[model samples]
Each structure stands twice: as C-alpha cells, then as structure tokens.
Target: MSFGDIRVAERADWLIERVATAGTLVLRKLGETRAGEKSVHRFLSSPYVSVERIVETLAARTALQCTGRRILAIQDTSEINFAGRDKKRRGFGPAGDGKTPGFFIHPVIAIDVESEAVVGLVDAEIWTRAAGRVTSRRSRAIEDKESARWLSGCQAAASVLSDAAEVTMVADRESDIYLLFARKPERLNLIVRAGQDRSLADEGLLSMALAGAQPLRSSVVRVAPRGPGDKGREAIVELRAGTVRLVRPATVRKSEAPEDVELTLVEAREVNTPPGKTPLLWRLLTTHSVTCAAEAENIVQLYRLRWRIEQVFRALKSDGLALDDSQVIDAERMFNLTAIALAGAIRTIQLVDARDGGPRPASDVIDANFTVALERLSKKLEGKTLRQKNPHPLGSLAFVAWIAARLGGWNCYYKPPGPKTMRDGWNRLAATLEGYALATQHENPGIP
Candidate 1:
C-alpha cells in the first residue's frame, strides 16, 4: 500500500505543529480542541498507518536529499519508559530497566558531512523485549540479540544513501561487534569505538598494541555542555594511530565469518585533566586508512559527530518532547507517535544548526508555502547594516534560522542562540504562519 496525499499533508502539518509546541507528545496540546485532538488521536491510532511505513516514507525523502554528498549515518538507541504508568500500558514489555513498561527506538539520522546539516532519518528499529530470562551472549547470535541494530543500520545506510559519494556508519562502543566488520555492506564505511580488550591476530592484546605505539600528536577538543548554565570545557588530547588485525572471538556464534579483519585504530588520550574528573579516552576502529596525524585527527573529528544523536535524545526526552509523559495507553499508538516525535526532534535540531548561515535549503525543515511569510518576517528583523542583516541567502536553512533566532529574542549582541532559543523562535513562527494562512484565506478566498 502507498501513503495517501491526505495522510502526507496531515503528517506535514503535524510536524510543523510538533516543533511549534517543542515536541510535546500530548494530543490535548497538539490538537488545541476536542475535534482537533480527536483527529490527531485517530491519525496515530489509524489501522492503516504502521510504524514501518511511516519510517520508510521519511527514508525515501532522505534518499532524495543525500544525492552526491558525503553522508554520516549516525545511529544510537534510546529507551522510552513510562515509569509508574507501566501498569496501565498495554502491549509493552520490560524496558531496559527490566521492569518499566516501554520500548526502544534505534534510529539512524543522515547528515551532510560538509554542511553539517540534517538530511533526514534513514531507518528506525523499534521493539519490545518479551518478558523472560535472556540467553547468554555466547549462546545467541547477533541476529537474535539487540546488537544486530548496528548491522541493520549499516545496511539501511547503504541502501538509502547509495547515491552519496561516501557513507560512514558511526557509533559508540556498544557497536563494536565482529559480525559487523566480517559482514559489512558493500561500500559502507564504519567508525566504532572499541568496547572490550580482544585478542589480536599477532598474538597480542588490542589495548596494549595501541598503548605501545608512539603518540601521533596532540590537539584541543571541545566537550559538549552537560546542561543549562554549564559551558563545556576543552582538553588537550594525545593522538595515537595504528593498524591491527582483530581475531574473531570464540564466543561469537557466526563460525562462517572471517577469522581476522584488518582495520586502523585511532586513540585519543586526554592529558592534564581537571582534578576529580576522569580523563577522556577514545579507541576508534575504522575502515578508512590513517597513516598520518592529520588523517587520524580527521577520523577523530568525524567520530565527534556522534554527539548529534545525543542531542536528538535530549530533544525527544525531557528537554524538548516529553515522550514519557504521554497520555497514550496503547503501546502500538505510542510507538507510531514516537516515530513522528523523532522526526520532529530532528527538525528542531536542524533549525538550531542553521541559526547562523548554512548551505542547506530551507525546505529541509519547512514547506514552500511558508517561504513568502518567512521573507516578510526576515524583512521585519533585518537592520540597515550587513552585520545587522541576515547573512545567509533567502530559502537557505540558515536564512530561516536567523529569523527564528531573532524571534526567540537574540539581540545580535551576545553569544549565538542555542537549541532552546531556536525552538522558542520556531514555536512563534509556527503560530504566525497559521494565523497568516487563516487571515489570507479569509480576506481572499482564492489564495491558498
């Protein structure tokens, strides 16, 4: 079956409304009226709309935008637990905590490597674990375990980003699986942090090999802020790079997989750390070659983009959309709503990314109907000077971002606007667009 045009319009309107409301999952706030709320509920509860189809629609859009770009397929898993409301929830099993009623969402978001702009969602893995005692890792295959998300994510990236010049699958330590390397998709690159000390093909330990290698160089790296009022700090880190052969663990169930895989290892060990704080260490394994310090640093920098997924989590959870506070009692509807909220969270982040001028088009986050209104709003915000005026071209993501930041109350006097300011500005813009459209239709019945 295909997604109907009416369904597309409804979802598009929902995306706009969701961002305007800071990703709230409540139907009451999203609908704003009894009829409106019921419509939203019906949309989510519709038997015709499945989670897979919803995600596939978004993936198709992402594929179109990623053509001829170096794409980063960043994947991460986040839990959505209903805490005390687990009892009332139906169709939900034990969450990560083993008791809460919720499911997990593992989503891969495509980002333009050069522009640092969001492309769109590629795939999402949403599932609920059955209530039972789990088998040991050695007894279960990667396919049967939660760890298969990495391989699935890579395959999805390869299929969706086939037109891209280059594609790299990046993730944290939990993704350091041998099957991922042994059975990687064609032309798909990987950058995963090592999680455990494994045997090397040369009869040596993996950690000792990197530690024994000479330091490549040192550089300063920015640490992300922990929360509000906490400006993150930077630290000087020593770099080390080497190529090592990794032996497949005996515990792995896939006997047909390769016995050994050769990959470069890049390590960044922080020096002169602040008191009471542990030093930062990153053991990155990648398919790309790194023979020089510059190449090693490049790999490290790319891995830093993994933080984007972390920000997405913040937006989807307590900071932006409070999915846990959702009033939905059915697990299926909640899962469907989660997919939309995930996209909305990314949309909010995209606006934040464009607060300054950027290369992405505004269509990345808004439809064409709002372009004229955005232009009029831009005129109202622009001053007489170049610095006072918008720096990005019209119809660009950055152009729309400047309007959002200004509407959010940035004076062009202080630090650039953050996520909160961007979301607030977007909220105001959404309201303004609705009012403008209504007023336009009222005064001129022919204008749509």
Candidate 2:
C-alpha cells in the first residue's frame, strides 16, 4: 500500500494530458486571463483537481488493492472569497467584512492521509451569507450566498463516501454540530471538534469518572487565531484530561426554542486569555471509542490532517493557480471555475510527487525529460553561435524542444564552461539530470 514501488510513467502522460485539456482551460478563463498572467494562473490552478482525485482514488484503491491496511477517509470544508469586480460579483453579496463582496465554495474533500493522496472531491455547491440577526432557513436561503447548494453538495458527498471502508469523517468545529453528525446516511464515522458553548453535562460526568482514576496534568500549546483578519494573537491553553457532550447553539424556530445532544469528551482544554478574549478548548467527540492516550492522540492527529485542505487552498492560489482572482460570473460558472481550479491543485500535487518521486509516475518527470531533450537539440544543431544569439540557450522555446528531444533519446553535449555560462549551464545541467531520471523511469519502469 506504500508508494515504495509502482512505475506509472505511462500514467503520468495521461494525467498531464487531462490537465492540459480541462484543468488549464478553466483556470486561464477564470480571471486574470487578460492580465498576461494567463499562463501563470493556469499553472497555479491545474493541480487541485489532480491532487484531490489522486488522494481519494489512492485511498479507496489502497483499501481494495491491499489486504492488510485500512483506509481512513478525511473530510473538511473551507471558504473561498470573491472580490467586488470579480465576474461572480452579481452572485456574491457582502462577505461579512462589509467592504468586500464574495461567495463561498465549500469542498468536502476526502483523502487518504496514510497514502498521502486525495481520494474524492465534493466540489458541488457552496453556501454563503452575510452575518445578520433573525436568520431563518427560508430567509437565510434567500440571503444565503451558497449554503443550500453547499448542503446538497455535502449530502451527495455523504452518499458517495458511505461506501468507503473504515471511513472516518474529521472536521473542524463548524461541522461538529447535529445537522452534520446526527443523520449520517452512510456507513460513515465522524470525529468532529467541539464548540465552546456546546452542552456537555454527560461528557463532564464521564470526564469526572476518568479524571477520578488518574490525575489531570496541565499541558500548554500555543495556537494562532483563526480567520483571515485576526493576526498576531496567539492563545496558550492549559490542557486537562476530561470529557464533555457537544451541543450546537439552538436557533429560534417559531414556537420552538433549542435543543442539545450528547457526545463523549475525552480531553478538554482550559484556555488562558486576556479580557475580551473567549476561552475555548475542543470538546472532542468521536464514534470510535478512544481507550488509551495514544488512541486519543491518533484522533487528534487525524483531525490535524484537516489542515491539508488549507494546503489545497495554497495550491489553488500561491502554488500556481490563483483561485481568488477568478473572473467567472454567475453561480454555475463560478462553481465550474472552482472545479477546474480544484483539478489544477490536484495536478500540482501529482507534479510535485512525480518530481520528488512517488508510487505512480507523474507528468512532471516527463516534462523534465522533454526539457533536457530540447536543450540537447539546441546544443547539437544551433551550437555555440546560438548561445551567443540567445545566451539563455534553454529559453522557453528550447524547453519545449528539450521535452521532445529527451523523449527521442537525444544526447546533450557538454559545452565548455565559461565564466558567464556557469550559472545557466549549471541550471541546464540540473535540468538534464532531472531529464535523465525521468527517462530512466520510462525506460525501466520497474527499476524503482
């Protein structure tokens, strides 16, 4: 089940072709296409799709492909914002900040952390709304940016992921409520982070039982505040071993007031903060029975993998695809655009894994190989005179040739080192080395 062996050099090409056709097209058209950053934006957005699918597929495939190891299904969601001038602005309302306009894209992504690959993506719908008082479901849906759509999306993902074996749903505090937990349609497991005001009388009793058996010790870990606006505030909380029931704050519904639910709390935190700061510690609840400290730690770590979704966000933006700068108008177009960007982020993960080396072959290696081939071709035919005309022999055009030449097994001749040529030559040499590695993978697929 490990990525230790498996030659997918051929598969790399297939993935790359997919990215080129669907993934890249959506990213470039999303936004900033007219700014001459089309290529840059395209590159940034192509990886999300590949990575998400790869991780999900790998996790499912591994469970089926391997007999001993079980697959862990991880699901989490985050918000994607849009600007006023964005094409989707008409669809977007005030995004809580009042100054900016945006809509949210909620992706309930499932990944196999053990294998470090994305298994499935739930990039269907998003729900967004501005903060206000007297929120009702009908009124909220009207004002809701994308929540109804997001709900449907989450429901569909639940149906699809119900089939995953040994699947565990790990999410942040937002998903720790009854709406998501109480009615799981599939054979799914959940371990959600608890909210501060969650009613935990039952959990408190159980915690007291466990606490009576063993002494509670204080452990401190510093955590940075959540959200985009909050900066530089770090909270150091004292951790104690205890249990608490998780309850969602009740929404006033006509004649009905509110209700609470019970969940096991294993470890509770007592936050130390200055005045005006809210005290919070996770009233963690899980379907899986946590017996020992190690088991509790495992659950905590699994929840931590929720952060991988953030990495997925970065891959959508800083890595190569800028999801924030999207220009797609209308909700449907924006969703499609987001899907494409997700695909791009997935592809980026594959690219990194391929170059860094993983179980399956990545197109990045092929890219590296082709790049070297063109450099060699430029050297043989154009020679030193070409270098004089364009000192950077491996210009963008040469890179394309390098890809073709390496695939064709063209050899690169060594150019005599000159003072001005060393840096670029060294770079080319590195490219050649990468090309050689890639070519070797194709030539001897089983060697790894």
Candidate 3:
C-alpha cells in the first residue's frame, strides 16, 4: 500500500512515536500494553509496510533540512549479525564467519558540511548474500555485482538532495571502484580513500606519480583515541597533491570501451610518530580541484567527517538502540523495524550534536509538549551560578539538550553529553511525560 493509505499512514505514525518515546527496544518491551504489542506485530506483518517507502519519506524530510545549505552525503556499510543464535533461521546469509547467518546494511546520511550537524538519512539498502553464489568479477557487468551498492547509493542521494546547493559523496576504500568514477553524475562529486595503486597514463604507478610532488604544506591535527588504554594525541602531517589521468584496466564488460579518467590525488602522511603509535597515511582520490594547500586541506577536513556515520552505527547497535538483541525472526519484519530504528538513531545524534552550537528552534527537532515539560524541569536542574545556567536561548534545540544532559547526570563541567547520556535522558523524559499525562487525566476525567 502507498504511504497515502489510511491504515499504512496510521501504523507508520504510531511506530515513529513509539520508537521516539522509547529507544529501539524489543517489540515486547516497546509496547506499553497487550493491545499495543499486538498492534505493532500486525503492522510489521502487514503487506502495506515497506522499508523503501519509509526510507523515501525520511529522505524527503532530509532534503527539506538541506534547503539552502551544502551537505556531505556520507556512505558506509555495517553487518547485522544474528548468526550465533539462529542457525536454522531462513532468509539469511553468511556473516563475518562463513558459518554465521547475517545481512549487510548500507546507508547514506546527509550532514551539514560546515556545522557537522547530522541532517538525516537519504537512502538505505539491506540485503543478504545467497549461499554458493560465487561469480567471476572479471566476466560479470558492474551492475550485476554486489559492489554496485556504492554507485546506487550515490545516485539515490543525488536524486533525493537535488535541491541542495552542493552534495559531496564521501566514502572509504571499499568505494574505490573504477567504473563508479567512469559513470558518476556531474552534479555529484566524490572523495574516496584510495584502495588500489593503479597504472597512470604515463606508464607510472599511482604511488610513484604522487611521490614526485614536493610537500605543499604541513598541518597539525588531533587524533582521537583509538581503543581502551590509548590516549588522544596531536599529529603533524605533510600534505602533497597532484593531478593524473588513470589508464583503463584491460578487463571490462564486452560492451564497455576503455577510457581514461582525470582525477586529483591528495596524500596526507604523518611525519613523526610516538614510541608505539603507527604513522597515519591517507591517499585520497577526488574530482574536486585542489589548486592550493588550503583547497587540499579542505578536502582532508571533509574526509575526516566520514567518521560521523560510524557514530550513527554506534547509536543503532550498542550505545543507544541495542538492535542486536531484537527477537524478531522474520527477515521482512526485521528490515522494517531496522528502518524505524535508523531514523530514531539519527534523531538522537542530531540532538547530541546540536547541544553546543546549532541555532535551530527546539520545535524543529522535538514536540511542543515535550519542550514545555523540559522547560519546567530545567529550572530544578540548573544551579544558581551563571556557568550552571542554560547557555542556549529559550525554545532552541540546545536549550532542551541542556535539560536532557542534566537529567542524564551531566554537571555542565565536563564535555557535552554523548549518545549514551542522551539515551538515558530520553528514557527519563519519556517516563516523566507519561506520568504527567496520567496525572492530568485523573485531574480532569470528564474534559475528554
């Protein structure tokens, strides 16, 4: 059924509200009552609920958020592993281990490039690989292969964000496909980490061609802590950039002819490393011009924002949603639920990121009733000192965020609240709102 259908629209609205009030918990835990549980199950099982339609609606909202702004369409893939628990489960494929059952989800998220605020999701695809379906990459067309997800994601984002003044597709090494560069749209630009060292037009390797250029500039960047027991450090890296024409590979689809593609290569290599740290080296291929060191650094800064999608994944799985613990056995139902969870995760990130600097209205991200409740709670949470007072304007996103952070145990002394803090705050707020509704109903029983 279309989104316009009454039943479909009502179910969609109900699911979104439930997910927002209570983060992506299991179906049984998500529903507050027996009737609510049954309704959610029926909605998920209905033929009218579709993952594509849900994603399209969210993408349309994201496009509206991107009006009159430049956005970075970041793409990445993460595996949803349900293998260890469900050996006999149908409609699944191999995961990290060949014997485990799981599927892959790739999503494209739009973020404001300058402010680094997450706008929303543009599109997403979920699929499973069939067992014993190996094929020769050399003989098959690009469209017939699984690697084509990269190109398809880019095309979808381009269409959805057509009104955006500028859209840059940011990806990691897995997106370094030769055919992708050949067929990329003119309006969509790419900045992908180089994965392969291919031959250049002048009979030199890509690495060798880049090595000839002298260092144009050096800059210092702060590297985030990697894992447990590691502290963050500042790194000094030298930058080098050059333009080259890549030679086409000998192996291609029979119908396709070889053509050279012109690209600008930017390399950032750490000059010095500490005692036990590994030096950072990144070779980036891009269509954007890098005429000066400032331009090259801008590309480097854009590439760094790729980690924003990683945060989105964290919000979906362990930090916020706990999606892996879901008990749904049906693949179709799980896919639909995953889409709703994804939208919830984006909302959480948007709130956390807008805590300090984003100047948007609170009504833009949250409801009026919720904001009113938060305002009442903020007075009790804030201290008498100015530093403890709300620094954001009333009715702004940062204002609500400050109230949530305080509820989550933030003392306004350390760094702003993270995803985990926001999750805790959201749970408390939802419960508080529920209590208020109950009290109001008891006080005015005949008003309704």
Q: Give the candidate number with the greatest TM-score.
A: 1
Q: Which tens-of-lDDT digit does each residue in 1-448 have in candidate 1? A: 2456577556645644564445577888787789877878887777767778788888988898999999999999998888877667888989988988789999999988997777788999888889889888777777888999989999999998899999999999989998888888979999999998879999998888886778889978777776777677887899999999999888765565888999999999999999976688989999999999999998988888888888888888888888777888888888888888888888888888888677888877776667778899999998887767887888998998899888888877668887778888888887787788897876645434
lDDT by residue for model 3 over 245-282, one digit each (tens)? 87788876535635788999999889978788899888
Worst 10-residue stretch by lDDT in candidate 2?
417-426
As a whole number from 0 to 100, the lDDT of residue 274 in candidate 3 is 79
| Candidate 1 error regions (>4 Å) | 8-22, 227-229, 383-388, 441-448
Q: How many Å off is the CA of 63 in candidate 3?
A: 0.6
Which parts of model 3 have CA positions greater than 4 angstroms off? 224-232, 368-372, 433-448
Ranking by TM-score: 1, 3, 2
TM-score, prediction 3: 0.92
- Report lDDT per candidate: 0.84, 0.46, 0.81
Q: After superposition, how far is residue 96 of candidate 3 from its true place, in Å?
A: 3.6
lDDT at 329 for candidate 3? Answer: 76
Per-residue lDDT tens digits for candidate 2, residues 94-123, read 564654666565565656656655533544
Greater TM-score among 1 and 2 belongs to 1
Superposed by TM-score, candidate 3 places the C-alpha of residue 199 at a distance from the truth, in angstroms, of 1.1
